[model samples]
Target: MAGTFYRVQCADCENEQVVFGKASTTVSCAVCGTTLARPTGGNASIEHEIVETVESR
Candidate 1:
């Protein structure tokens, strides 16, 4: 399966992970052995930009 790299911190375990693509639905924290949050797929990248319009009175 295709996957991507992610860096996340465990809520219960408070451990940081550098997941490399195709992460499991439930991953155990290596430090405190806590369940981590997993992606539900269908996620897309988001970008934002601002445009300014000037008017003279």
Candidate 2:
């Protein structure tokens, strides 16, 4: 089984950090020294796909 992970960004330093471990936990950023909110489950991958929709008026 794979460990859980989360995507968190620093509020002060504007840094992106990823936490890989257990669920319902918190992780800290290594760069700006800030704590971030981690997800409940899944891999440590933060990459997400964006879908854009255009509507004609």
Lowest lDDT sum, 10 consecutive residues, model 2, at 48-57
Tens digits of per-residue lDDT, candidate 1, 1-57, equal 554555656665555665543444555568887655444564322111112212212
lDDT of 2 by residue, 1-57 (tens): 545444555666667655554435545567865555445465223323212212212
lDDT of each: 0.47, 0.46
- Report the number of the highest-TM-score candidate: 1
| Residue 29, candidate 1: alpha-carbon lDDT | 65
